[model samples]
Target: QPVTEEPSALAPPAAKPKSAVFYRHLRLDFPAIVRGEGSYLILDDGRRILDASGGAAVACIGHSDARVGEAIMSQIKSASYCATLLYTSTVCEQLCRLLVDSTNGQMARAYIVCSGSEAMEASLKLARQYFLEKTQPEPQRTHFIARHQSYHGNTLGALAVGGHKSRRLPYEPILSTNVSHVSPCYAYRGKKAGESDAEYVVRLADELDAEFQRVGPEKVCAFVAEPVVGGALGAVPSVPGYFKAIQAVCRKYGALFICDEVMCGMGRTGSLHAWQQEEGVFPDIQTYGKCLGGGYQPIAGILASHEIIDTISKGSGAFVTGHTYQGHPVSCAAALAVQHIVAEENLLANVSELGPYLGELLTKRLGDHPYVGDIRGRGFFWGIELVEDKATARPFPPKANVAMEIIDLGLKGADYSVALYPGSGTADGVSGDHVILAPMFNASRAEIETIAD
Candidate 1:
């Protein structure tokens, strides 16, 4: 009998490279990413594309970090798996503690989970559960009031709470009808010619107030919003006192305020939490992700305030939420390590110091461009809204795919090797275009200049 030889583990698999992967764009052939180093993505063809947007603003700490790798390895070698149903690992607890501490007691408890969508789903359920644990159990308070042009997540529950028309169109019939939309506090396009920030905020607040009244305030569970609107609105931050005014409406209606900071929080907006910069207003419940783990692992979690935690504690002594990998050791360890690096190196301070320069450079370079209509953001996250006519702020039609074209141009050749985050529907629900530039928090002045150039 002849001896049989097996395929070497080092060799590539026999199947077609792209066959097994279900990409976001099924019709397009995707580039193969071999590796990442610092703020650049290395392609299999030896191209080094600068990662300016950090893959939808996820990688805040950068691509390659030996510290995070070692921490993940150490956890894997010691104890990689632990069922949160039966037990909790120290790594998970530590990450939770760090998260809670980062909030400075404004948010009391942290429930660890996997992705931003998962975190948003958990938040929705938790909001409902909080109402149930009330003295009278206001179960009728199941409706959510969210802003228009917001993207919470793609999950069914999260989708229902978001108001992005294009994204919700396919599932509108199937999605829950309990959620309603109010106008977002968008200053650039929504504000009047002579409107001050205060007047704009008041007008938006009135819109929210009217929505709550129209929906029957007592029947609403919570008013959900992103402190700095991400994705759907292209990194648009609310005008001063906007959050406070909206939060007041929620309070007046005896409803909870759930802030979805999945994309804008975790120091992406120069502060660990975006709400911290919003007139000292703290949310009842906050969902966080993206830069939370700095793209080191699949980890996201919710931070519930003391008021919410106490309510559930007093009523049934239980909050109904569970996930099998809720507190996975390896994921927690990786996140913890990334956060530790963030703190030890003071990356948040770096964001604060260098963020203004990024904005200035973007304005200096792209401000007067024919296609640039608006440039707005805070911290290291900035968005450039592209338009066909800057004077009229007329967005190129969605059919043109202007946002994607800019991204394509940025990634074209070694001469223009840069990656940007593309988004649509910035002007309205269907025809706007914008691209975001969210570099690593630790990016130097030179790199920031390069990105701007």
Candidate 2:
């Protein structure tokens, strides 16, 4: 029942997709989402679809959150926007305070913005300024190390550092040449046949070290990576001791470790930050988005540790970057409210409790399916890899479009609507394929069961 753009003989009965206005199919034909309640999105025609992917895993508290709405409305009633440069609003200050408290003061500052890409950009600029202010201004220290098959953002700078070859291909001629990529710690694909977990972690750490050394240790500013691989590689978690080892290497070379938790952080992985869940590992700089504002008003920001901020404050008095919409009041207040409700209701507790059961249910429902190759994730984030053969883990050719097929069936025939967050080249940035599913944090067990089944 999966609809393909290709011509096929055995297609199911359905309305033809209507013409889109903005872009092509890969560009648009997405339904006009009319309204949402709980985990369900009502389309313009009134078809209720389960929001399994939570609109790119952004709506953590789900739609119809009265508290978040009320908080935003209250802020709007007074003032909707306030430029952080001249006037500092109480909402922005309180939000920063909350974020700092969440990290137990290890985080010294938060730079808020209107989108995830903006947050990532601010993080990079902030890191650059931090070193300059400290008088360690090594202009050559502009290089960064990232992993393959990972997605950070769409802006040229962030996209340049990202590993998704397909997304970066068109912009290669113009992308910054300061980035070098190493292998991601995708155990299912990157692990050797006879190697132990410790060995694999060491290998990846060693790769990072070599990259830093190749780029010149003094020139490498930071190593950026997602704590748990999202987007491009599905919901892959690194091997045990992976982040610790990587952190050690980065520290040995005096490079900052920037964790891009735009997808996996903010209670999506049972902990407020995914890096917090890792043993003896925390990032020097961190970026969060998506659930930070629960997809309410488009908000995100960078959190810097006290060490980084002190170095900057003592060195330079002002950040070099400028954005008119940075630290907009309504977005910050909405995010604060979402964070508050998440705490007051103890929704993270549910994410932890329901996550394991959902995993089990997924395995129970699809374990025996011939095409399912790998099922992996943590907390509410999950991914299913489909292959031509499960034993060999050989993915279907792009021409076959296995993920699209399964997703189409899951959406239409299954009487459920879900966003198909799949990745091509999940194995090596070119070949492996997978579908990611991240349900809302406040989702009911029964609703989760229905969605899973």
Candidate 3:
């Protein structure tokens, strides 16, 4: 009998090895990054792509910082992992203390986590727990009120509270029904033709109030919002008095105020906390990530106000949630180092000083572009909104993928070698396009100019 060859032996080799990693976009091929040098990402093909958006506004100090690497190594040599429930590491304590101090003691406690989504999930649970732990417990307070076009996180609880239409579409069936959304404080479109800022804010506040009443104010646990809307609305900041009015509504309804500053916090907006710029808008519970660890390690956290902490302290003395890596020592060490660098170098001041010039450069360059409908942002975080018709402020249809196309082109170095963050559904929940530019906190004037150019 003739020897039979196995089918595998007869087959030819594949053109490329199959990737074990699951990519966000399955069909698209991604560039392999070799290393990061300052603000540029060196690709395997030898191209240098400027990290203009800081990889979704996370790399505050840019990449490849020797200080962060040293801190990580030091932490690993000492203590790499610790069961947060059983023991707390010094680095974790120091990082938490630094966070609380940054808020001038307004935020009384910090709960560390691995990502913004985890931090947001904790915030939701803690808010609900706060009501349960109150002197006169309001167990009925199970509802949450969030703004339309806002994004908190992708977890089930976070997704329920977030009002981004596209993101919630697939998960709507499983999302909790206890959350409802009102219009966002998007003055660009929400503001009527001749409406003043104060009037727009009042209208928004009234809408929020009506939603609370509809949901039954006593049943609402908290009202969640981003200080300056990121991702979903493309860095849209509330008009003056917007947060004050909305927060007043939350107070009136006896609901806690939760500010999700994952993208806009950690000096990204030229302030230690985004709420610092919004007068009289202190949050009862705030979630922060992105720049927290400066992309040096996976870390995010929730800063709870004294009232919430006191109630929980008096009631159970424990937050009823835990993650296997909640207070990972290595992550905390990296974040601590990143935060110290920001403070030592006065990066927040740099953001403030160069922020206006960056804005000016963006406006001057793209303000007259036919597709450029709006240019708005604060500090190093800015967005350029693209439109189909400038006069009508009409967005290109979602299928067009205008923002993604521009970003892809930039990454491919067709026109410019820069990476930008893209946002869709700006006009409604499915039609507009905008690109975000969140440069590193330590970005120099020349770097900002290159980004804008």
Per candidate, the number of residue pairs that clash is: 0, 4, 0
Residues 165-258 of candidate 2 have per-residue lDDT tens digits of 8789989999989888999898877888999999999889888988877788988888899988878788887878999999999999888899
What is the C-alpha local distance difference test score of each model?
0.86, 0.82, 0.88
Tell me model 3's lDDT, rounded to 2 decimals: 0.88
lDDT by residue (tens digit), candidate 3, 25-128: 88776666767878878765556788999989999898999989999999999998999778999999999999999897789999999999999999999998
Query: Could you list the CA RMSD of all candidates, in the order they appear?
Result: 5.7, 4.9, 7.2
TM-score of the candidate numbered 3?
Answer: 0.95
Better of 1 and 2 by TM-score: 1
Alpha-carbon lDDT of model 1: 0.86
* Candidates by lDDT, descending order: 3, 1, 2
Task: Please tell me which model should have the higher lDDT, number 1 or number 2.
Answer: 1
Over 4 Å off, model 2? 1-28, 135-138, 418-420, 426-431
